[model samples]
Every structure is written in structure tokens, then in C-alpha cells.
Target chain A: MEDVKVFGLWSSPFTQRVIWALKLKGVSYEYYGEDLANKSNMLLKYNPIYKKVPVFVHNGKPLAESMVIVEYIEETWSQMPLLSQDAYERSNVRFWSKFIEDKSMQMMEFFVYDGERQERAIKETLETLRVIENQSGLNEKMFIGGNTIGLADIALGWVAHTLPVMEEIVGVKFITTDAFPNLHSWVKNFLEIPAVKNNLPPHELLVEYYREKRKVFLAMAFHHHHRH
Target chain B: MEDVKVFGLWSSPFTQRVIWALKLKGVSYEYYGEDLANKSNMLLKYNPIYKKVPVFVHNGKPLAESMVIVEYIEETWSQMPLLSQDAYERSNVRFWSKFIEDKSMQMMEFFVYDGERQERAIKETLETLRVIENQSGLNEKMFIGGNTIGLADIALGWVAHTLPVMEEIVGVKFITTDAFPNLHSWVKNFLEIPAVKNNLPPHELLVEYYREKRKVFLAMAFHHHHRH
Candidate 1:
């Protein structure tokens, strides 16, 4: 009895990464949609450190962190390999994956604040995007690491679906053909994958969710600025 | 016919991690000490994104990031496994490794700054340590993951050696017998390892180097504060 489970929030890109990986690997597991405002006891029990969503459990053992869970899923199930068979190629994929994962939170700065800070954040985000465009092997291959969608693609999965929502909310465009042509194409290619295409949360719902969340973030930022 | 080379700095904890992993696996390689002030063209070509140290080259293909290189070493050579053969245990080790790696820079904030910032940073560092001491499986096992030294140990290896130097320079102590007994013991166990003990940079030189670096950091901080 293969008892696998994922505790996640639907609109979260982190959560979606795990869901998409599971789907890609054809692993059927129970899904528990977590309410972040009021987290479940199971989540708290599973991940005492972070207590964040995308906690993957197999049999009785639990795992946290989206990319970690995705890697676990890939390793546990042999079908639909996300990383390459070659050690060097696998390391290359991991290098890009770590790069994007480390920057994932910082890349959302544009949507979280406004005015001069937003402009600065936008520049930083673009700088990171530019690095991805130029250095991440996107020109030679369709995906970030290689021709096929792999770990780097999954690590960067949020940009395809959630980044557009953030872009719309912030009213600033990134990943355009003129600015980041390679990323623009890679984004299209990533979304076209059946596992990714089918597993995404509804676009309108995501936009609405993030729009409200952005308002909260801006309000907190305003309060923080005033307090300082 | 094996070709393995490491481009690294002697004192950098990140670079030391790769070196220690190699030593632990008994994989001998040529080491090139990089001067951060004037990084080599090879380092630039190998890791253009960060232009950083600890670039591991195996058969001419270069890999960047300390933990990433460590993982590559673990995969390439299976002699003394840094991770568990069991999937769940490996994920657990990864979780703690990721946690420590993410907080590694932030934990150094106490050493980087002074006054109120240092206090706050110290508190943050203590909080992180508390989490590790209480939550991580250190109570049951001799190391972070299990009885043997593994990836998490290598990931948190800096804390064992370098943190003491930072503490000595800054005149503050963490991981004491009273504060973090588990980590205190873990530190003792980590240092006892042949790979770790033999591969460490000389202590007095490290202290002198960091003392100089800290002065520069403080000066930069003073200038930035005045400018703002």
C-alpha cells in the first residue's frame, strides 16, 4: 500500500510545484488543502520547524520544503525523471534549481511594495531574470537546464503561472519577448507540459487571491514605513 | 583516469565544505586558492553568475555552490555516504541542511554589525540554534541526521569551526553547554572527524584575517549609515 500525501494551499506556487511533480510522476496521493490563516495540526506536527505548506508524507514519514518534496517524489517514483541520469548534468540542473529557489522570495519584491522601493525591487528582479536569460542555458535548450522540462523548470514553475498574476497586480511587465526573450519562450514551453497544464490553479482565482494578498502586503509595508 | 579539481579560498567556509567532502570521500584533487580581490579567469568562466569560489571541476565540467558540490561528491563517489540510503532519512537530512544553509548568512549578521543590530542578529541566531537543538534529531543521534557525519553535518560544519572564531572576535558566545548542549556536543563530534580536523584553515590566521575583514565591514557600514 503506497500511502503518499501532500498538505498544501491551492494558490501557492510552492504548493503547486509539489502537486505538479506528483502529477508528472503519476503518483496518486491524498491532497490536504491547508488554510494558511489557520494551519492544521498535522502540518504543525509534520513540519515543526517551518510549519509551512507542501508537507509531503509517504507511509508515515513527512517531508517539508517544496523543492525537497519534489526531489523526494522524483526519487521515490522512477517514472518521468525530472533530473538527468548523468551526474554532471544532474549537478548542472541542481545548480540552476538552487539559484532560482534562493531568489524565489526576492523576485516577489515587485508585487509586495510600491514607489521607490518597488522600482529598486523591480531592478533587482530584472537583474536576477537577466542572469537567468543569459546564463541558464535557455538559448540552446527550451527549458532552463535542458531541452526537456526538468528540475530547474519545476523549481521555476511559479514564474509561468503565478508571475503573470503578480505582473498584472503590480502593473509592471517582465519576461517580455524584447526584455527576456529566452525566458518568454521557456515560460510558454513549461506551461505546455501536460502535467503542468492540467495541475495549475484557475487563473482568475489566482489573480484575485494575489490581488488581495498584495493589498495586505502593501498595507503592512506602509505601516512598517510609518513606524520607522 | 580521474580528473577532479577545486578552485577555492583557504579561509572560506563554503570552500572548506567542498574540500572536506572530498577528503571525507578520500577523493584527492588539485586545489587552486583564489584571491577574491582578483578572481581567476577560470573561476569567472566556470561560475559567471556568482563569480564565486568552491567551483568543483570533474573531467572539465565545473560545478558551483558548496552544498551543491558536496551533493555531487556524495553522488559520484559512494564510499562513505554523507546521506542515508533510505529516502525518508535523506529528505530529513536535506530539510535540516536547507534550513541551516538558508539561515547561514543571516546568522553571521551578529558578527557583521554592531550595537542594536548585533543584539537583534544575536537573538535571531539564538532562535535558529534553539530550533536545531530542540527539533533536529541531535538528541537521539551523535550527529544531525544520524550516528554518522552526513550532509547536514557538512552543511552546518561552518557553525562548528567558524562560529567560534566569530564569537571570539565579537566577544559573544553561542552553542554553549548551557544554551545549546546538543549542538555543543555535535560541534565536538564534528571536529573530532579526521576529514574536518585535518582540512581546517589555521586558527590564528583565520582570526587575523576575519579581524581585518570585520574592520572593513564596520567601516563600510559606517559610511553607508552616514550616506543614508
Candidate 2:
């Protein structure tokens, strides 16, 4: 087998996605912890398009973008399949993955804004969550990709861990048992997976990191508003 | 062989993506043109989550999202392979496809905005184009997925056909011969493919439709500004 390497930031949910996928597949890879403030030359070279971490380099060839990398990993390593056997099932997984990827940033926007902007983000976030809660068939299945911990579940893994940290720091709760029971149960089931449980970053460290990041984000938002 | 059906809106680039992919693979399916004003029950039933068009149903299992459908088609019908054989190559294709999918709407913001917002959109559009032009490796390869028309090419197919129509309607051109030579060549090469050439919507009709759509978009923007 060729050598495998992962360039990742410690606190990134995207990085954790890749990490969990690798662990689930039982693929041994050399992990490089990147300081996001000063990205490594390898990270830049590997992912020149985004200049972001969570790049998986296998046998010298590099693959970037977390979901894409996860898919590639699934395809390359057949053991412990991340997607379904049926093409349509796989498409359903991909659909939810794309949906979450598009909305996840917007979901996070509430943490970095105040007043009307924050309210707008919160509403949008709830709207997105409602769609997932109602339409994602979470009540029927333990995971988004069926009974197994599959691709869509991995894509949504951030909500289980990272979102809670964000909620703690922001002092706002979006996912409550009464409001989104299906999604709440999903969070529990997803985190219970041994692969996900072992691979997550420590909670307190992530909260501290995001707390500082949120301060910077709010400051920038204020600066933009003042200028306007 | 199971029954195949496609629920799509004629004018949507996303619908065309699935159409082109199916055509390229020589998959026979019934195309149901959707009325956006009053969408069909099948469209709603098949794509309940988004209630969007370009829902492909095969053997009674429905799938939503254009790129996801394209991947399903590729996986189901192995002939006329839409992704590369190598895992790394496949990841590269997916990376570009995801990048284009994410940025295409942001790039379109220039079409409906005026004044400072329009200026910001134009700047963003140029920046996105520059990134694609410089780093997408289109100069050496015929398509972003490599020598063959693959998922990324189909994902970006709209830019070749729809973007020109949008530019004409908006009275602005972003991709010129000198500005994006590789991409320009790519457009020509992409259009020359029989599957794509034969499947595209009529150029004049697209321009007319987009012009009307832009009017509606601008009206909404005006309303938003006034309300805010």
C-alpha cells in the first residue's frame, strides 16, 4: 500500500470529517496539524484552489475539499463503505451532503453577527434545520444514509459536536429535544459511532478557539457596518 | 431494465446537466417539463425536500440535485465514464465541480444588482474567474476532469451556454478570448461534443428568459433594500 498523509487544522469541522472517514475505513495516515494562520507550503501546494487544510495526500497525489476527499476515500477503500450500494441511494446521500455543505456556513452565520443580521441568520438556520428535520427521514433511520454511518452522516457530523460548542459560546440553542426531536436523536446516534467518538477534537479547546474567532468576526462585522 | 423518468424545467441549467449526462450515457428516460409557477405533483413528491426540478427517478426511487443525479447516472451506467479511473483524478474532478457549483450563483449576482452591489458582484465574479483560469489546470487539459467531458465539465456546462446569454442580457462580458483563453477554448471544445451541442436550450430563448428573470430579481432586490 502507498503512503497516506492528511493535512488538517485541529479545530476545523471539515478536517474532522476527513479524520472520521479515515478512521471508519481503518486507513492509517500520517497526520500533519497545520497552523491555519500560517498555512504550510504543502497545504498550499496540495490545495491551491482553496488554500485550505483537510487535504488528503495518498501516494504523493493530493485531494482537497472535505466531502470530495471523503468520497474519494470511500471509492478508493472499499472496506466499511461510506455510501450505499444502490446508485439512487448514493445520490440521496450526495444530495443531503450538498444541501448541508451549502447551508452549514449560513447556519454558522448566527454566531458571528448581532441585531437584525443575527436574527436573519438564526431564521435561515432554523428554516434549514426544519427542512432537514422534516424531510431527511431521520425518524425512520438512525443515520442520514440509512442504518449505517454513511457519507451524509459524516458530512453532518459537525452539527453533533461543533454546533454545540458554538451554541455554548453564543449562549443560544438551536437544537432542543422538544423542537427537533428527530435531529436531536440523530445527534446522539451519530456521536455514538465509535469512529466519530474517538476522532472528535476536545470540546473545551474548540469552544475557546471559536470564541476568539467569533470576536474577530463580530469586530469585522461592526467595522463593515460603521463604514456603511 | 427498470422505468426511468426525469422531472425538469426546460430553462434550468441544472436540468440540462442531468439531461446532458443521461444523453451522453445513452440512457433513455421520459422527460416531464415542469411548470415553475405551478409545479407538478410528481416533482413535489420526488423532490419534497427542496421542491426543485431535475428530479431523476429510476425504478421508482427518486433523486434530487443535478450533480447528484449526474453522479448516479455515471455510477449506474459505467459506459462513457464521467469520472476518472484514478481516485486522485476523481477527487480533482469533484473539487472543481463542487467549486463551480458553489460559486456559480455568487457569480450570477452581478446580473441583477446595480450600483455598489453590482460593483462588488463584478469584482467577485472576476476574482472567481481568475482563480479558475489560473489554477483549474484547463490550459493543459481539455476539460477540468481531463481529456474527456466529465462531471466537472457538465457542472460548468452552463457557463459556456447560459453565461453568454446572461452577459448579453446584463450588457457585460466576463470571458473574452484574451481574458480567459483556456476557458474560451474549453467552451468551444465543450460545445463541440455532440451530446452537449445537441442538448442545450436555444440560445435566443435563454437570453429572453434570463432577461425577464433578471427583471424579477432586480425588483426583489429593490424591495429588499427598501424594507431593510
Candidate 3:
């Protein structure tokens, strides 16, 4: 039996990325939910540097970083490949994955502010989605990389679920078919995957959780603004 | 015959990563030096999204982002492997590589600013170095993740070369032996590698180039400040 364990947070998109990857690969592992307010000692011990969730341990060795863990899962289990066999295709997937992950935090800016700042964030978010719609080859494929779900798809999975919750809280919509036809179709296809569809956290609970979290984030941002 | 070509800037650390990785693998390719002010049409066609070098082309397929290109080089050619074969060790290398690369841009802030902002950047740079010195296992090995040169080392290779040039211009030094003994030693070991040693841009020329570039960056920052 493989001794695999994952320390994660329930509502974290980063944690969901790991869970969805493992489910896609059909790897069974113990899951330990972490409280960000009071992180577990084991979680701290496993990932002292980041002290964050989705710390994966396999056969006694521990790994941090969600994408790093996902890539390791792909490397260790050859059951369902998250990347491509062709080196060129794999690099293409990786390039898009990096691009998406790098922008993930910034994408949340739309939900974190109001007024002109929020409008700027929304415009930037739309611009990013526009790039994905046109440039990521989504026009040709069902998913980010190809017809089959892959690493880039998992990297971008947050857009299908968490992004909607954020949009709901902010009373704004981003991925309409008129504006982002390819991404509109891509989101629907991504959510249709059994691994991704079945494994997501409850939508209502996510909305409630983020609603409260957004209050705190906005308050913090306001405080920061006043200080500056 | 391999059709390999690198579109790069001679003074760019990002471009140097691709060059070093190729040299480490003993791969030969034609090099095209890009003029940032007058970027080539081929370069723009190759990487339309970022439109930046080093854009690597192998057998006519083009790739952008320096680290992404370096990874492709590692994946394609098996000679003088830049990443560990073991998945666990490879994950470790990748984690540190991501950490360092994520901070690389911020690390240059000290060079771009003066007075308080520069001091803050310097302090943050030291904190980052301190984390690597104590936590990244440089105390146990000659390079990051192992005793041999690998991806993380290449990711961090900028610090060994370009950082010194920036420091010379700004009159601020980081990674002194007294402050970062492990990194100081690692720098020596990294540069001692014939691939890294021989392929570096001429130091005096790099110094001259960046000296002029810094003046422009400072002027731009000052202009932006006055506008605000």
C-alpha cells in the first residue's frame, strides 16, 4: 500500500488542484483538513517554509506547493497522464499552466476592492480571460491544452468554480459567451470532467465562506490605504 | 541534425539561463541577439504573448519564458541532466526553483530605487538570502537540492553573475561570505562549472550595459513618481 497523505484546507483552490489531480490519477490518500487560523503542527513540520496547505507526503517524504505536488503525482503514477508525451506539447501545457497560476492571485483582485480599483481589477481580469480565450488555443481544443483534461486544465480549474463564487459576491459576471466564447465553452467542458465535477466543495458553502473572507480582505485593504 | 536556435539579449540574465542550460547539455544552436527597442518580427511571431527573449526554437517550434525554455532543453536532451532523475529530489529542485524565480523580480528593486525604498528592498533581499542560507540545504550540499548543478542552480544563476553588476552600480552588496557563507561558497562552485564559467557575457560589457539601463529605469521611476 502506498503511504500517501495530504494536509489541506477545505475551501482552498490550491488544495482543490491537488485533490482533482489525485482523483484524475486514481490515487487513494488520507486527507487532513487544515485550519489556517491555527495550522497543524504536522503541517508546519512538513512545510516550514510556506507553512501553507496541500502538503503532500508519500512514503515518508513530504512536498510543498500545490503544482509541485500535482506534477509529482503525474510523475509517480502513470495511470492518467496530466501532461503530454510529446516534449513540445508538454512545454506548451507548462507555459499556459505557469501563466494561469501566476495570474491566479491577481485575478482575485476583482473581488477584493470596490469603485475605481474594482473596475480596474475587473478590466484586467477580463483582459486576462481574453488572452486565454484567443491565445491559449482554446478555440481548437475543449480544454486548455487538448481535448483530454491535463495539467493546464487543473491549473485553471479555479476559474470554473471559485471564480464564479467571487463573481457572485462582487455582483459581476466575467465569462459570458459573447465576451469569451472559447473560455465560456472551456469552463463548461472543464466542469464536466468527473474528477473535477465530483470533487469540488459545495457551491453555497464556498459563497458563504468567501463572502465573510472578502469583508476581512476589504477591511484590511481599507486600513492599508489609510496608512499609506 | 538538430535545428536549435535561441533568440536572446546578450545582457539578459533570463537569456543567459537558456544559454547556460544548452551549454551544460553540450547542445549547439545559432544565436540571434534581440534589440529590445527594435524586436524582430520572428521573435514577435514566436512569442506573441510576452514578445520577449529568450525565445527558444527547437526544430522550428518556438518556446518563450526563460525557465520554460530551460525546462524544455532539460526534457529534450538527456546529456548532463539539469534535473534529478528521482521524483522527490526533482520536486525539491522545482520547489526552490519556483521560489527563487518568483522572488527574482523583487530582488532587483534594490538596484532600481534609492533611499528608503532601496533600503527596504535590500533588507528584503537579505531576508530572502537568509531563508536560502538556512533553509534551502545549501549547508549540506554544494548546490541546491544536491551536490551537482541542476535546475534550481540555473534558476538562481542570475544572483551569481548579474547581481554583482547591479551591486556595483548601486553600491550595495548582497551574499558576502560573512553574511551568506553557504551562498558565497555555492556561488564559487556554480561559476567554477566550465559551462557556466565559459558562457558568461563579458563582465565589463555587462557592467557598461546595465549602468546605462539603470539610469533609464531611475529616470522612468522618477517620472512616474512625479506624475502621481
Candidate 4:
């Protein structure tokens, strides 16, 4: 068997996505933690376009982008499928995944900045959650694509683990028992999965990491605002 | 056979992507041209979130987002396969497609505005082209995937057909034989396909449509800049 190598930053939720998918599929891989600020040549060569983390190297070839790698993992392993068998169902799953991937940043802007910008981001975040809640029937389905944790569930996985850390830091919570109840429960079902539960970065560690990162982010944001 | 319907604006290159894919795969579909300003209720219902086209309705169920719909078409039809058979190859195809889909709007910003903002957009757009030109293997391959026109090629289909019209309006050409010889040749290979060649809006019609659109966009840009 060829050695599978994953180049990622431990704290990146994006990197965590590939890890969860691989673990859920019961594949073995060696993880290499990269300092994103000082990227290794291997990481640079593997992912020159984005130079981002979660570059999956399998049997020498590398694939960049977390979700793209997740899809490759899904197709290659072909066990415990993340997407549905039916094409329409797969399209539906891909739609929600794409929605989450597209909106992930905008939905978390409140955690990154303060003031009116954060207020607008809060509204946008709620709308995103609302759309998902309406789409997912939490009463019937445990995960996004009925009973099992599928790709969309993985796509929204960070919302379960990271969103809370961000919410705690900012003192603003987007998901609650009253609003986004379906999505709220979906997060619970998502975390209970052994693969996900076991693979997550320690809660306190992520909080600490994001806390310091937030200060740097705020400084950068302030500088960017003033310059513009 | 159930009638396949596409709701889109004719001038929109996004709509043309679905059109090209269907035609390439030898699938029959009814085209419904919608006035984007006063969108049809069916269009709104089909694509509630984006409220944009090309919305693909196979029977009653609708799929929004041009590339998403293109993927759906490729999966369902499965004749003229738009992606490679190997998992890694498919991932590569999808990576580039996602890249194009994400950057499409930003790449076209220069065409929509003028002056300093447009200058910034122009720099961004060139960077995007440079990335693709380098990564795409355009020297060896006729299209993004291979010799055949696949999903990435379809994703970038607008660049061949629509970008020229935009260049004509702005008096700035992005892809040239001297600068992007590979992408330059790719545009030629892409347009040579009969499905793409015949499906594009007439040259004069597209130029006229975008000319009018550029005015509206500039006017809107002016208002937005002043309002801020």
C-alpha cells in the first residue's frame, strides 16, 4: 500500500474536514503540520495556487482544496459514501455543500471584526443558518443527507466545533435552541459520530489559537480599513 | 422523454455553459429566455436563493448555478463524459472548475466599472488568467481536462465566447498569443467545437447587449461609489 500523506495546519477547520472524511472512511494517513506563515517547499509545490493547507498527497500525486480532496477520498475509497447514490440526491448534497463552502467566511465575519461590519455579518450569518435549517429536516434526519454524516455534514462540520469558540470570544451566538433548531440538532448528531469526535482539535486549544489569531486579524483589519 | 427546460437570459455566458454541455452530450432541451430585470415567477421559485439563471429544470425539479447544473447534466446524461474516469483526474477537473466558478465575477469586474476601481479589478483579473495559463497544461492539452471539452473547459467556456465581447467594450485584451499563448491556443481549440461554435449568441448581438449592459453597470457603479 502506498503511503498517504496529509499536509495541513492542525487548527484549520478546512484541514480538519479532510481528516474527518479520511477517518470516517477508515483510511490511514500520516499528518504533517505546516506553519502557514512559513510554508515548506513541499506544501508550496503541492499547492502553489492557493498555498493553503489540507493538501492531500496520495501515492505521490497531490490534490489541493479541502472539499476537492474530500471528494477524491470519497471516490477512491468508495466505502461509507459521503454523497448519495442517486444523481439528484448527490446534486442536492453538493448544492448544500457548495452553499456552505461559499458562505463559510461571510457567515463568520462577526467573529473576525467588530462594530457595524460585524452587525451586518451577523444578519448574513443568520440568513445562512436559516436557509440550512429550512432545508434540513432534523426531525427525520440525524445528519444533513438522512441518518448518516454525508459531505454536506462535513462541509458544515466547523459550525459545530469552531463556531462556538468564535461565539464565546465575540459574545454573540448565531445558533440557538429557538432559532436554527434543526441545524442546532444537526450539530449535535454530527459531533456524536466517533470519527468526528475523536479527530477534532482540543476545544481549549482551538479557543486559545483563535483568540490570539483574532487579535492579529483585528490589527490587520484595522490597518486595511485605515489604508482604504 | 420528459422535456428538459433551461431558464436563462440569452446574453448571459453562464446560460451558454449549460447550452454547450447539453448540445455536446446530444441532449434535447427547451430554452426559456427570462428578462432578468423582471424575472419570471418560475425562475424565482426554481432558484429562490440566487434568483438567477441558468436554472435547469428536468421535469419539475430545478437546479441552479450554471456549473452545478452542468455537473448534474454530466452525471445524468453520462454520454459525452465531461470529467475524467480516474478519481484523481476528476478531482483535478473539479478543482479548476471550482476555481473558475469562484473567481468568475471578480475576473469580470473590470468590464463592469471604470477608473481606479476598474484598474484594481484589471490587476486581479490578469492574476487569475496567469494562474490558469500556468496550471492548465494548455500546451499539451486541447482543453482543460484533455483533448475533449470537459467540465473545466465548460467552466471556462465563457472566457472564449464572452471575454472577447467584454474586451471590445473596454478596449483591453487579456488573452493574447504573445502574453498567454497557451490560453490563446485554448480559446481557439474551445471555440472550434461545433457545439460551442454554434451555440454562442451572435457576435453583434452579444456586443450590443454587453454595450448596453456596460452602461447600466457603470451607472450602478457610479451610484454605489457616491452612496458610500
Residue-level error in angstroms, candidate 1, position B173: 1.2
Where's the lowest-lDDT run of ten residues in candidate 2 chain A? A82-91
Task: Provide the TM-score for each candidate, comma-separated.
Answer: 0.98, 0.96, 0.99, 0.98
How would you encode candidate 1's per-residue C-alpha lDDT over B1-228 as one tens digit per residue? 889999999989999899999999999899998999999999999988889998999989999999999999999999999999988889889988999999999999998899888899999999999999998989999998899999999999999989899999999989889988899999999999999999899889999999998999888878888897
Query: Which pairs in model 3 have colliding backbones?
Result: none
Please identify model 3 stretches exceeding 4 Å from their true place. Answer: none
Question: Model 3, A44: alpha-carbon shift in Å?
Answer: 1.2
TM-score between candidate 2 chain A and the true chain A: 0.98
- For candidate 1, write residues A125-170 as lDDT tens digits: 9999999999898999998667888988999999999999999888
Error of 4 at A72 (Å): 0.3
lDDT by residue (tens digit), candidate 2, A1-228? 769999998899999999999999999999999998899999989888788989999999898889998999999999999888877778888889899988889999999998999999999999999989988879899888699898988888999999999999988898999999999999999989999998888999998999999999999999999997
Worst-scoring 10-residue span by lDDT in model 4 chain B = B136-145
Model 2 DockQ, alpha carbons vs. true complex:
0.84
Could you tell me which residue pairs clash in candidate 4? none
Residue by residue across B80-111, what tens digits does model 3's lDDT show?
Answer: 98888899999989999999999999989998
Ranked candidates (TM-score, high to low)? 3, 1, 4, 2
Q: Which 10-residue window in model 3 chain A sums to the lowest lDDT?
A: A110-119
Per-candidate interface DockQ score: 0.90, 0.84, 0.90, 0.82
